[model samples]
Target: MDINCTTYELEVLHKIADAADALKLPCYLIGGFVRDKIIGRPTKDADIVCIGDGIELAHKVASSFSPKPYVAFFKNFGTAQIKIPTPSSEGSDTLNHLQLFEIEFVGARKESYQQTSRKPMVAPGNLTDDQNRRDFTINALAISLNKHDFGQLLDPFNGLKAIQKGIIETPLAPDETFSDDPLRMMRAIRFAAQLNFTITPATFEAIKANANRIKIVSQERITDELNKIVLSTKPSIGFDLLSKSGLLQLIFPQMMLLHGAENVEGMGHKDNFYHTLQVLDNIAAHTNDLWLRWAAILHDIAKPQTKKFEQGHGFTFHGHEVVGARMVPKIFSRLKLPLNEKMRLVQKLVELHLRPISLTKENITDSAVRRLLFDAGENIDDLMLLCHADITSKNKHKVKKYQQNFELVRMRMAEVEAKDHLRNWQPPITGELIMATFNLTPSREVGIIKDAIREAILDGIIPNHFDAAHTFMLQKAAMLNLYPVQQP
Candidate 1:
């Protein structure tokens, strides 16, 4: 299949072909760029494989430009990369007006791996050998860059057929493919999720059989693929595959805890696992924020721990939001995910996932809305999104009712925010001012008075103004027999 190359892309191919011809070396465009081109996916990255010194070819191509671009060469890997800058329509010479296209050049080579490590022993080889070493058939497709065979596709493995069939099949034996580099297992699932493709049955079973091999892969690499899957159009496809293939249990058993439901006295709870996926897909429809998606994945993470059976009530996962919030840090640490504000955002959402739901069910009071806005602060909209996505009941009536209540809660939150300005709200009173006014050092009394003022504002007992908080603070302090140093 001939891919319709863009004008700039054709220019790049022509330059590379000219360079290869001058050096008397064969070259082809291979891997993801080729695959995505056939699938009509927009791609900025290209891989060119030559049957000669890749670094030399890269330098030759770099010289073709008026002001030669920098070629980053990796001697150990026999690979080189050139970042070609495209001129912008603005006609500006500034770097901001330039777009970069990454072209990776590699010498055609084969690899052999030891059972213990994913790293391979590389050696120079023909194009067929390089294709044989590819992880998936669809990724093995290559387009020639020689004058005689320019744009001709080389499909030794019928990778074009695999692309047509929307199938992810290994170029070689599935067992060897995954066992050699267990990271491929995650890639398989990621590709399937990204392209809406299916892994061949044999490849799926091989993944299951070699699931334990994933432990050898680095956590950074594993999580990288996991993040890609999470960011896919419909992430649940990849996650469900992970669970069924037994990879989820090995990598993330905490999520597996949400799988099954228990029944007693003719009462049962929804499977929290599937429920979480539904919430994830729901949130995905509204936003592409990875942290928000993570919040959905972990919103009910502690349901298993907090699950309790009651005589009248079927099951109650009390304080699950709080418990799940506590679990986020450890999980993030284990997965090698960034433990920065991103982690805190997910934790905060997990902790507050149920607050909006509770407000929706009960009377939507201004005080409740004020408190929600205060706690959620800048993330109020995200919290509401999570709550809306959390509604996954099979009962259409219940779903409709919850949605209506959610709208009411949103309206109440907006009204209260406009009136009280409670988003990111801190009490008008400060602990330092309270201490100075009372002529006392930092003590439990200051904490008590500070908390009282905050609670009063949240409960609507006093306005969020300094005068009201000061008045209430003095009264509470008077009751505690702690008078101010001097009267105002």
Candidate 2:
């Protein structure tokens, strides 16, 4: 089968073939470039494998370009790379306007791994050996770049059929493949999630059998794969596979805790695990933000921890949001995720996930809306999206009622925001100003006055204007039997 190639790509391939010919070496375009081309996916990198010295061939190819691209060669790995700038459609000279495409050259080689480590011993080998070491069949497909057969596909493993069938199967025996490099297990799930494909039954069972081998892999690598899965169009597919394959229990026991629901006195709650997945998928439908999806994944994470059954009440997870928010940092640290603003965003969302739901249930008030705006600040919209996705009841009427109430709350929020202008709002009075006005040191009285002013504004007893806050501050200070040292 022939793969479609753009004019520029064909020119680059010809140059590579010319270089290999000059060196009397055989070369082919292999792996993701070939696979993605067949599936009509946009790819930015090309992998070229040659039977002779890949670094030498890469240097030769680089010299053929007008402005020779720099060649970065790794002698230990027998690989080299060249990044060439693709002229913009408008042919702008601005550096930012140009797109760079990476071409990686590697020599065909075989690998053997010891039982204790994922790192494999490498040696120069033939094309068949290189294909044999591939993780999956679809990824093993190759296209010859030789002048004799410019775009000929080499598919001894029937990888093209697997691509057509939408299947993810190891090129070799699944057990041997996974046992050699356990990280491939995560790659398998990632591919399944990305392509929305199915893992063959035999391949899946092999993953389950070798799931424990994942321990040998580093946390950074594991979390990298996990993030890719989380960013897929529908992430729940990957998580469900992880759970069924027993990898979730090993990698993330906290999520596993959300799996089962219990009964007490003929009362039971919906399975939090499935509910979390539904919320994730719902948020996925609305936004592609990775942190927001993470918030959905963790919004109800503490339900299992805080679950309680009372005699009259069915189930109560009164403080799950608070608990879950507190759990975010530790989970992120354990998973080797970023500890900066991204973690803070997820934590803040988890803490406030229930605020909009509570507003929907209660009488909509300006005070409540103002408080939510102040607390959520810039993330109010995201918080609302989370709350909307949180409405996952089986009863259609109940869901509709909640949705209608949410709309009412949203309308009220807009009115209050337009009138009060309280998004990311702070009180007009400052503690330092209060202290300065009262001729006092940093003390409890200053804190009390600041809190009073803030509460008065949010409670609608005073306007957010400086004059109203100043008057309220003076009134509270008088009540405290204090007088301003200076008059304005």
Candidate 3:
């Protein structure tokens, strides 16, 4: 292999080779590390497989370092890890400032999964068996770590050729490989998306045939891969693969549901599925926050549910925000995503996604901006980003016009926010003050007056402060026939 290993990596691998020679064992540096090194991709963690005791090999490797680096071993899985920290992280001058890498040692093993479960029965195997078990040909390549050939490339499956061609193909027959572990199907598509590589014809066919097997995988694992796809430079690539392979329908049926558009009297709505992907890609360019991109993906998710065909209008999705907001929890629950503030943030964005667009339509008021600021609070920036990303029309004039009007809406928001202090702004008057000055208990009158006070504050009838709120409360109180009695 002409793949140049960095000085640190070479030192570690040569150490492993020496240790294996001393103990009379066989081992190889395998899988992702080799693939990444060949492709000039940086990798901090390198995987090594040993025919003998991997734990012993790891301990010896750790001891070989000058300071005797610590070895963390997993006895059950027969694996161990040793961290090689450069001066950058540990601030130790003993090592070069080049970079740090972790070397993981594991016993060469073969696995057999049960028909209904992904968990595998495992036993020690040779290098060939280990290579055959890898998910993809590109990942199946290994480098010798034995005495005879310390850095020899062992490509039993022509992985180098596949890598050169920018192709993702399984080592074995696609169907059998997918049948053994269906998650490989998702992995293949994810790899294709991440590397911008093409899926081979047979591999793509296998994904379609094995789509149902994805149901057996856990939602957490599925979401983990989905999140990786979402975080890719161009996420739309993965969504297209998911849709084509049919796994998208099984894993996230909601997004897949956004697939088609129907024509009513030669008037048709855009294909929301493709539009959502475009919006996701657009949002991705500006921010790398995963949840914010999620908002973009789901901003118009409820259009299908709220679709209405009017005689004059083509299609109106009235109150899709409300429906979309309700759908967030169910989608999050099904995907095993966090049900915490992240979900609520996505829900809020879905609920108010159309509000800014409404501002661009007709005569928008300062009060509208105030209400938007109050509702969006700390999330105003992200909400605006999602709204800006939502402008995905192919019409250049319409796009330019909406952008200009959107900028106006932004200016109005800034003007109103400066004067009113209404981004997450609160009502100046408290219910406690209302009860204290009036000597009243918690009652319908308290709620009624509280609601009125909030309205007055948001409507700009009163400045958002204590004195103005207190003075307004008195007049409103007189109308309700409530007055403080005279003191002795």
Candidate 4:
């Protein structure tokens, strides 16, 4: 098959072909570039595999360009890369109004792995050897960039058929392939989630049989794939596959703990596992934010920990949000996720997810809305989205009622936020100012006055003005029996 390529793409391919011919090397455009093009997905990167010194071939290709793109080669890995800039008009995608065509060159090679490690011992080999080492069959497809067989299609493993069928399978024996590099197990689930493809039953079973092998992979690599899965359009597909393949049990058993529902006095709550997945899919429908999606995945994570069955009540997960928020840091650390603002965002969203829902059930108040806005800060919108996604009840009437009530909560929040200006609101009374006004060093009394001022404003007892807060601070200080020192 002639792979459809833009004029710029064809130009780059022809340059590589010419360079390969000059060096008497057989080169092919291989891997993701070929697969994505066949499936009509926009791609800006291409992988070129040659039978000779790939780094040298990259230099030749670079020289052929007018500006001579820089060649970055890795001697230890026998690979090289160059990024060619193309005008936005001719580019597949533009970044800063300029698009980059990244081409990576690697000599065709074979790989064998030790029983203890996923790192492969590499050596020079043929194109077929390189294809055989690919993680998935669809990714192993290649296109000829040679002269006589220019634009020729190479399908040594019928990967095109797998693409047509929306299937993910390894080119070699599934067991050997996964055992060689256990990271491929995560890759399989990732592809299924990303492309909405199905893993063949045999391949999935192989993953289950060797799920424990994933322990050999580094946390960073595994978390990288997990993040990709989380970022997919319908991430639940990948998470479900991960659970069924037992990879979730090994990689994120905390999530796996949310699997089952127990009946107490013939009253059972929704399966927290599937409910979390539904929330994930729900949040995905509204936003593409990865951290928001993560909040959905973890919103009910502590339900299993806080589950309780009272004599009159069926099942209650009271304080789950608080517990789950506390668990976010440990989970992020374990998964190698960022411990920065991103983690804190997820934690904050988890803590506040139920607040809006609780408001929907009760009589909405300005103080409550102000506190929600103040606590959620700039994340109020994201918190609202997560709460809306959390309403996964199968009953349509119940869903509608909750949605209507939730809308009321939103309206109240907007009104309060407009008047109170509480979203990302800073307390008017600074601790330094409190200390200054009280004519005292930093002390518990200063903190108490500050808290009292902030509370009075949030409670609407005082205006959110420096004057009102200053007056309240004095009253609070007087109550503490600490009068301000006279000005010098």
Candidate 5:
């Protein structure tokens, strides 16, 4: 009640307070729910830190609702959670489809840690003890839900003032805090990026000093935090902080390799690291697709390895797109990211990012556009977006010129796609049909004919039709000293 809540939210809190009163327990809304509400950020999940048995309070609260909410409790962790369904909208016939309000209940506890693992040795404690264990001051703010101080705000660590100033600071000494749970370091940066806040100088310095301790955390947890950073409105902030803190080298060394620019013969290239971040920001402004943003991040990942300075050209990352595509799987594997279709989408975008831009510079050809459409397939638009974002030239006129060229490429694609339908194009002539016509098994001749037919269609030599491809197939077959057998 200390923070503004919707009518339904207040009702749920009143129920929780009623339940706690009946049980003779002190309960408070704590953690992100309190912080987000105070900062005017929309939040659904709330954490209830109770002075007594949290699981019992959860069950007691669940019984108050009409359709009893299920109390899922983990005895080992002494925590419980319930998701209360939203009341149906007025005059609606169907069931409530809105997201349930998720509340996690846990007894106030103090924690001690070992050098080997972040798994804490826990024991029951008071609210002050629990607040002392929070990773950041902003997250430690709580709202009392007891009868005596139901709407009272508790900012024991001056969390409200920290929130007001938009700063991230740990309640305890940051080194002790981070060493106890190294994941908190990642969380600190993530909050900074998410809230557009600054990490207190001392806290940030502690993060740098204990950056190596991040190795003790699991890859999955690290990647999870990294993904949160990437999904934030301005992810470059987080990555920059990570790089400055030296955490990037430990957690993702491949990206760290992109940190510097090199100079040769009085010619230097733009720093690929900052260039990548600019591209990421550019793409983020256009789309919230995480994979597309990831594509922007990795579009130039192989630049460091492929960097070359020709006699005339200052710097050239020749074939970097191909090399970057090949590196995607390895990066994905190391980051503990999903190696499924999502990763493939990012890989495809990274590989094809240069294709659309190349088209903009040259005399646009239908065949070239068709090939790009075919290669990029369903992801053509996304690939185009990534390419546009990749143009990080600081010259305003140069950027404008490149964008105009990109517009031309997009127009060409539209024309070619409408006429040829080459997006996600499939070859009209199949290897099986070629083999059957030539009366041969799966041999080199079949593959040769199939490739030729596909190239012919992409080149606009033959219409994308089975009959034209069939005739073209026969003509090419004869050139190879092969003839189709007579059919019945």
Candidate 6:
């Protein structure tokens, strides 16, 4: 009952209360807004559940705001949203005092799902009926915003006990709850990962039993949950649960493929699946960058496909990088991820993951360092984080050695970056300049010359500047027997 409300939130609730009173309707502040408030996490989004028309409540609520926030009403779904600025950053030199907050209002409803589809048949219902349909107990908590019992907590399912126990359990029977919508099973695990909570034995078993029903859910919805799991603090925990509960194979068979190790000739490779998770957890510690964390999860994805046992030399994955790079596009497309630069960055990291580690074992040349800087450019730091995370050996000494070597690599990068400035670094000689210099337009020779210029810069063969690149270009052009065009 002791849920603290900020001054801004109090203002929001007062407006909402006024709106509900004007229409003579019952409404409650529910779900995430209530859950987050009790947990003391910062939140600017509110979910208001009204017994009557949610769209009309949203309109009335918007009218109550000072500037009359826009109400985006959806009649078919009985949902509406109003956005307002709510400041959300901390520092001396802060930006945006007022941040954009979203207030979504939906009618209290009960849902029944058919066996074949994930969509539920929804209709207006009483508060208890609405609470019964909640996916988990913790999410079922609601606060009254009506005049008589304003800010009163209503948790019939003892959601507070579940939150205190750090447990994820369904409000209703686990079997029926998950059977109605298998996506709830995923939501249970996702909540466990996000909240770092435990799934009770009954709930866990229900998920395992109903795991196969995940196929009925759309890939986008499934991947959205999968991504949330991947982005958690300890993603491996959720993924391991997904594998154990037999849900992963149905949803993400590719990741499931990384589960085991094969031994041949008294030698073997580490289970890539566990290794990938360790890398993900490690990257999570250093950054909250979601895409960078994704790169860590996928860094060694092609090891299984490229695995082969070589005599005496043991196991080798010769082209896993290339194979993994090739697999990225199809995987992204199938998984409903953006096929833009984010995908490309992941691909580049997978291909280059082993390079810095490989460098650590050798004399560690300047040319190699330059190439890495040039290839990685701005992403060099993230690549290093992934490389550091990739050191998941059981040997403490091996881990220490890898960490030490990474520090050296980072120091070397500082040196190289200072000298060459290759990050977002472009070659001084443009392809167009090369074309004009050699009196050619769009030929294979121009491409060859361009590659050579880039290579020379990456190889530390010359200073990364126009004059040096020009001199190298002329020499390379001479070797190709292409004469320079005279100035007109």
Which runs of model 3 end up more than 4 angstroms from their true locations? 1-7, 65-70, 83-86, 89-102, 483-488
lDDT of 5: 0.91
Ranking by lDDT: 1, 2, 5, 4, 3, 6
TM-score of predicted structure 6? 0.94
Write candidate 5's Cα lDDT for 411-472 as tens digits. 88898899999887777877778888889999888888888999999899999998899899
lDDT of candidate 1? 0.92
lDDT of 6 by residue, 293-399 (tens): 88887778888788888998888989888888888888899889999999999999888889888888888788999988888888888888888888899999989
Each prediction's Cα lDDT score?
Answer: 0.92, 0.91, 0.88, 0.91, 0.91, 0.87
Question: Would you estimate the TM-scores of all the predictions?
Answer: 0.94, 0.95, 0.92, 0.96, 0.96, 0.94
The list of candidate 2 runs beyond 4 A from truth reads 90-98
Specify the poorest-scoring 10-residue window by lDDT in model 1.
88-97
Q: Which ten residues in a row have the lowest lDDT in candidate 6?
A: 87-96
Candidate 6's C-alpha lDDT?
0.87
> Residue 10 in model 3: shift from native, Å?
4.0
**Clash pairs detected, candidate 1:** none
How well does candidate 5 score on lDDT at residue 28?
94
lDDT of 4 by residue, 1-488 (tens): 46678877787788889999999999999999999988888898999999989999999999998778889999999999998886567544543326688999999999999999999999999999999999999999989989999999899999999999999999999999999999999999999999999999999999999999999999999999999999998999999999999999888999999999798778989889999999999999999999999999999999989999988888999999999999999999999999999999999999988899999877777777778888899888899999999997889999999999988888888888778888889988898877776678988887788778878877899988888888888888888998887888
Q: For model 6, what is the alpha-carbon lDDT of residue 337?
A: 92
Q: How much does each candidate deviate from the true structure in C-alpha RMSD? A: 2.3, 2.0, 2.8, 1.8, 1.8, 2.5
Span of 10 residues, lowest total lDDT, candidate 4: 90-99
Q: What lDDT tens digits, residue by residue, belong to model 2 across residues 1-488?
A: 35776767777889999999889899999999899989988888999999989999999999998789999999999999999976554344433326798999999999999999999999999899999999999999988878788778898899999999999999899999999999999999999998999999999999999999999999999999998988888889999999999899988999999998788888998999999998998999999899999999999999988998988889999999999999999999999989999999999999999998898777788899999998999999999999999999899999999899989999999999999988878668888899888998999999999988888888999999999899899999999988999676
